[model samples]
Each structure stands twice: as C-alpha cells, then as structure tokens.
Target: MSEIIGFAGMSHSPFATLLPPARDGEPGGRFLADSTKVGAAVTELRPDAVVVIGPDHFHANFYDQMPPFVLGVEEATGFGDFGSTAGPVPVASGLGWAIRDGLAESGFDVSLSYALTVDHGVVQSYEMATGGAGIPLVPLVLNTAAPPLPSLARCVALGEALGQAIRHAPDPGRVLVVASGGLSHWLPSNDPRDPSVVGERRSSLIHGRQDARAFAAVREPRVRAMAGNPDAPVNADWDRWFLRQLYTRDLGPIVELGHDKLEEEAGSGGHEIRTWLVGHAAAGLPLVWDSYEPVPEWITGMAIGATFPVPA
Candidate 1:
C-alpha cells in the first residue's frame, strides 16, 4: 500500500515558474505550461491524491451566520504569470466536513465556505505542485485574519483531524496537506504591487546556494529588553507559532522557495511572500529551522514572541 505523501506548507510564490528550464514536448498555458519545476516536484512525490489547506487572502466574513460556503473558484488567465488547467476542482468534501465536526467537538461554532477564488497564493501553489497541470483538490479554507479565525493550537488540531480524515478517505495516497505562507519579512496584505520584487530577491538575496546562510540569518530572532526596540509587530510573533504547525512527522525539512518585501501600498508596507515546503519525513531529510538564531536588532522588541509553542 502506498503511504500518504505530505506537503506541509507553502504560499505558492510565483517565482517557481522560472527555476526549471521548461521541459519540451509539454503544453504551456494556465493549465498546460510545462517549462516549470513544479512538475518535477510532484512527479517526485508521486501521490495518488492531493489535499491542500491554504488560507484565503479574501476570506469570507466569519461573523456572518449566513456566510455562503465557497465550494468553487476560477481565476484570470495570467495570475502567476502563467496559466495551465483551472478546475472543476473536486474537493474530498469529507475533509471540510471533518474540520467542522472536529471544531464543534472541540466547542467552536463556525461556518465553512467552499465558494472561494484562489488568490495568487493558492493559484500559484496548485500550479506549482502539478507542474502547471491542475491537480484534483480538496480545498480547505483557513480564516487568516478573521476575528474568529482558528487559534494556532486549533489549527494544529485541524491538521491532526485532517490526517485522520484522509486516512479514512476512499483514496488518500500521496495525500498532500499543504499549509501555505509565512516565515518572516513584513508586509501588509492588500492589493500588492510588483511581484518582481520577490522574484529578484529570490535570485539575488536568497535562492543561490551561496546566500543560504544569509537567508536563515534573516529568519532568526535576537533577545532584548522591550524598551530597546519597537518596530516589531504582533503578527511576526504570532506567525512563529502558526508556522511551527507546518513541521509535522508527515512533513520534514522545509525548503525555502523564496521571500521578498513588496513596495509600500498607500504609504503602508507591502505584503510579503515567503514560499516554503515541508514534505514527508520518510521521503526527505530531517527539518532545520531559523527560529533559534539571535534576532536582528531591527526586530528585537517583537523577538520576545519567539516562544510560541509552550514547552509540553
């Protein structure tokens, strides 16, 4: 029996399109483009099915009792600078059902929306995963910034519950449980400007083997007295806890796909994209992290948030 394959996290940064020289004899477009590396990655994992959990940038209002569950989505032709196959994506609705039941079992009243459009984060991720072809999906919508968004621990529970759901699924091999986004760099998410900024940074500051150390350095935190600093925001600390969930037994050493700072939007900082991957342990090397490093002075005040998961 083939075991389930896990894809722990990634924000679907668009730069993936360029890494592999496009393979010849492959279709090119939103759903057919083959001159990309995303293809090889999946072929390597070779899963029988995929289950993706990505947070929606435009999450539906959670406060509304009448919230419409988003069961589907369609995007423009050139979302991530390419298009392959879009979907009549078939979600293993069971997973969402499991999440709702699991949450209720844990005592949280909430609504589920499957009626969603994949913003670039999700769109890019799926395309990247399938090597430009659309994969069958069970889309799990996470409430990223909503008032009643699942707590970090609750989200982790969601993962644990989801693992159980997939094991019970009729067909769940190569079962990819993808939690997209995050791992440092600050930017306000809204209408972002210039995807090129992230692309260039990936090539110049982070991607090459030579800059690997610099990349980890930026992700580490420095301990300091609060009065000595202040620019650090609450979200980074919060993200530390959330991103930790991506490291699972079914998931391992995360690959930092890319990271960058978008330009300011209306004088506010731009949204940041930090793409990464944590795959099945049996299939990959052990995981390494940047959290234990000394925090940079620029973010020392917020660095105190390094303690996300309470020692159990």
Candidate 2:
C-alpha cells in the first residue's frame, strides 16, 4: 500500500518568489527559508509522487462555469504566475485516475481536466518544496475564488478521501502531499458581474449587453487595484485566531465558517485555507512544526507547517 511519507503547507504568493522581504527574517524572508526547508524535506523523503492540493485564482475559472473541484489528468505546466518561475511538470496519471475515481465513488462531484495549466498556487509548491525536479504531480484544484464556496466539512471529507486514495494506490511509494495557499489576507473580491448581485443590475443586464459591459468597466479598477497593490491589507489578528483553531485539528467550528464569516474575520483570501485543510486531514497526525507571520508586502498571512507521523 502507498504511504504518505510527508505532508506540508506553504504560501504560494507570487511576491514570495518575485520579491524579497525588505529586511532579513521578515515575512518574505522567512517564507524563502521555510520553503527551502520544505524543499529539503522533499529531497530527503524522495517521494515517488507529489499531490498538490491548491486553489486557482481568476485565471482558471471565471464567473462562468466555475467548478468547485477539479483534478488535472494530463501532464500540466505552470502559467509563470505574476512573473514567477514556471515550467512543464510530470503527471502521475495512474494515481491521478485512481484518486479521481475514488473521489467520485466516495460522493465528491469533481471536474476532470485533461489539459489544465496550473498557476502559482500549485507551481510554487513544486518550485519551493521540490526544487522543480521532474517529480510527477497530481493537481487537485479547489474553487476558493468564486462564491457559494464549499464548506470546511466538505474540504475535510475531501482530504480524508485523498488519504484513502493514496493508501489504495497500486504502486506503494512514499508520496509527498503539499497543501498550498493561505493563512489570511484580503484581496479584491467584489465584482458587479458576481452572481450574488441582483435586482437593478440584473434587470439592466437583461435589457442590454452593453449595460453589463459598462457596469464591469466601472467595477474593474477596484479589483485591479486589489491585485496590483503590493502592500494590500493583512489581518494578523484573524490569522492568529485561525492558526489557533487549526492547531486543535477538530475542524468542527472551521466547518461551520461560511464565506461571509471568513471574509468578515479572515478576509476573502483566507478561503485559501481550504487547501491547508486537505493536507492537515491527510497528514493524520498532530502538526510537528508551524509558523505564521503577517506579510503585507506579500499581501498575505504567510504561514508554513508540517506533520510527522508518531513513532511506533
């Protein structure tokens, strides 16, 4: 039976890679150091395959045809996120299919993509944790960007299913599981085109396509600013609270936290924690190491941690 030899989490911010922290041991600086450590851990374990549980930005899914979850079934490449490093990566096709089938059988309505181009959320983990070697990868994409998001309980279920799938794999190899995305940070979330918005705008759009285009034109600048600002807002208090709850690993309160609560407290970007939840559940052990720092420069609540199995 296959085994999850290692599990880890890390920030996937493009600024974490493209820009250095203003000072030594700052958020970005620590991110680099910890990422190197994760990469070293990967080298040490030498897992036969790596499964990355991560989310996509607006790049992969837009307002139209958003999928809650997707599994990449083909050899995937990175989009070189925000000028960060990227390249083609190998795919563990057999294992990917196994997990896909397993998830479907287990009641997960996951979308499958034969030709998917992963962005920084998935790529940064490989670049930082594996030194971008030819280790085959399976990308499990989450819909953290769009609204009516999946529940935290659902995320935990997915993680449990993932662990079971890995365990039942035909080839028993030391597999590395990396959950990439958040601690806490807010970005541009509101858009006129959002499905949640309704009434007058919906009526206007129904009347004329040009009116809809005009509405988007008005709303685009704020969203663009949210993405472009290097020193976007960071909620350190919320980040700390989240880390405390995650440390418990019960996932009860977390499961109940809807997107509004997350946005109100942890910020919209905090939704990325869904990725971390997957890894936490799969690790099947109390975390051994964890760290958090609010890095406004990277515009994120930069965090990293890992879980090691207890000794027999």
Candidate 3:
C-alpha cells in the first residue's frame, strides 16, 4: 500500500510571482526562503506523487456552478495568471483514478474533471513545494471562495476520507500532500453574491470561464493595485493561534470555529484555511517546522509549514 510520505501547508499569493520581494530579508523574501526549505524537505522525501489541496480564485470554478470539492482525474492546465506557471501540469492519472474511486466508496461524492484548469492557487504552491520538478500530481480543489461553503468540520471529515482513500489505493506509492492558501487576508471584491458587488467584475466572478481572458485582464489590475496597501488587514494573532494549533496537534478549537466566526476573526480570505485543515487531517501528523509573517505588500499573513517525513 502507498503511504503518505509527508505534508505541507503554505500561503500562496499572485504577488509572490508577479512582484517578489527584492531582498531575502524582506517579509515576502523571508517567506520565499522558508518555502525553499519546505521544498527541499519534499525533495528529500522523494515522493512518488503529490496531492495538492488548494482553493481557486474564481479562475476555474465560479458561482455559475460551484462544487464543494473537485478532483482532477485526467489532466490539469494552469492559467498562468500573475506570471505563475501556465500550460500542462503533469498528472498521475492512474493514482488519481484510484483516489476518485476510493473517495466515491468513502461517500465523498467529489466532483471529477477530465480536463481541469487552475490558476496560481495550485500552481504557485506546487511549484514552490516541488521547485517545479515536474513530479506527477493530483489536484484537489475546495470551494473556499463561494458562500455556503463546506463547514470546517466537514473539511476535516473530507481529509480523513482522503487519507483512507490514499491508504487503500492499490499502488499508492510514497505520496506527499500540500495544502495551499491562507494566513488571514481579505479580498473584499471577490464575492459576487454580495449586493455591493456589481458591474463587470461581478459578472466575471459569476461566469469567468465564459471569457477567461477578459476576466484576467480585468482582475489582474485590481489585485496589483492592492500591492503595499498599508490598510490591508492581516490578523497576525489569529494566524499565530492557528499555527499553534497545528503544531500542538490540537485541532478541536479550529474545527469548532465556524465559518462566520473564522471570517470575523481572520477575514474572508482566511476561508482558505479549509485547505490546511484538510491537509492536517489527511496527514494525521503534527507540524515539525513552521513560520509566519504578516506581509502587507502581499496583502496576506504569509506562512509555511511541513510535517516530518515518515520513516521508510
């Protein structure tokens, strides 16, 4: 049976690619350096494949038809938005199919895509963790952006199911799971369901797949405009508290924190922590090394963490 070799949870932002920090000492740069360390840890483990659990930024799934969870079975392509990787991403179809079947049997009812297109959410984290080594991967997307999201407890349960699926796969091989996104930041204009959200941006958020290029052209500028905005919120306290829970292997408080309470404490973008919760539950291991920084320039409380590799 294939065993989980390791797990990583990290923050991702377009600015990490589009507007990287100039020096290693800067917040973004420091985060990048730590990310490299995480990548090295992944390399040392020599995983056969990686499963990336991440959130979409409306670049793929939109309000037009959003599912709670999606697993890419056949292939995945990157949108290359904000200068992140574009074009074909290597996929482990055989293992992916096994995971799909296992999830179904486990009562997940996860959505499957023959051809999935993802943006920086999956690409950025995968590239950072693997250093773009082209290791085969399976992409699992969570609906963190849209409302009526799966509850935090549900996410944990989903992760547990995923763990069971991986363990039961016929040829699971050594696998690494990477959870991408969050640390507490806000993107006020992201939710189209809000009454205040109107005009072309709102339409794009709801139906971006219809004309992805146009939506990209419109959305990129707005995101760039927030670069270095001092007023942008990043709840460092909340971020640290969340990390502490992971390190201590006590997720009860986190799982009990409802979605509304999470938003109130960590902001809308903090919803991305759903991915981390999934990764933690799936790996079933306490974090060994973790770091955090509130980077206003990137408009997020940046963080990176990894669990110790399983013994061979």
lDDT on C-alpha atoms for all candidate structures: 0.36, 0.74, 0.88
Look at candidate 1 and tell me the lDDT of residue 289.
Answer: 27
Largest TM-score belongs to which candidate?
3
* Per-residue lDDT of model 1, residues 223-250, tens digit only: 1122122354324443453345334433
Total clashing pairs for each candidate: 26, 1, 1
At residue 224, what lDDT does model 3 achieve? 93
Model 3, span 238-264: residue lDDT tens: 999999899866678998889889998
Compute each candidate's TM-score over C-alphas.
0.47, 0.84, 0.96
Better of 1 and 2 by lDDT: 2
Better candidate number, 2 or 3, judged by lDDT: 3
Off by over 4 Å in 2: 22-27, 190-231, 309-312
**What TM-score quantifies how close candidate 1 is to the native fold?**
0.47
Ranking by TM-score: 3, 2, 1
Point out the higher-scoring one by TM-score: 2 or 3: 3
Candidate that scores best on lDDT: 3
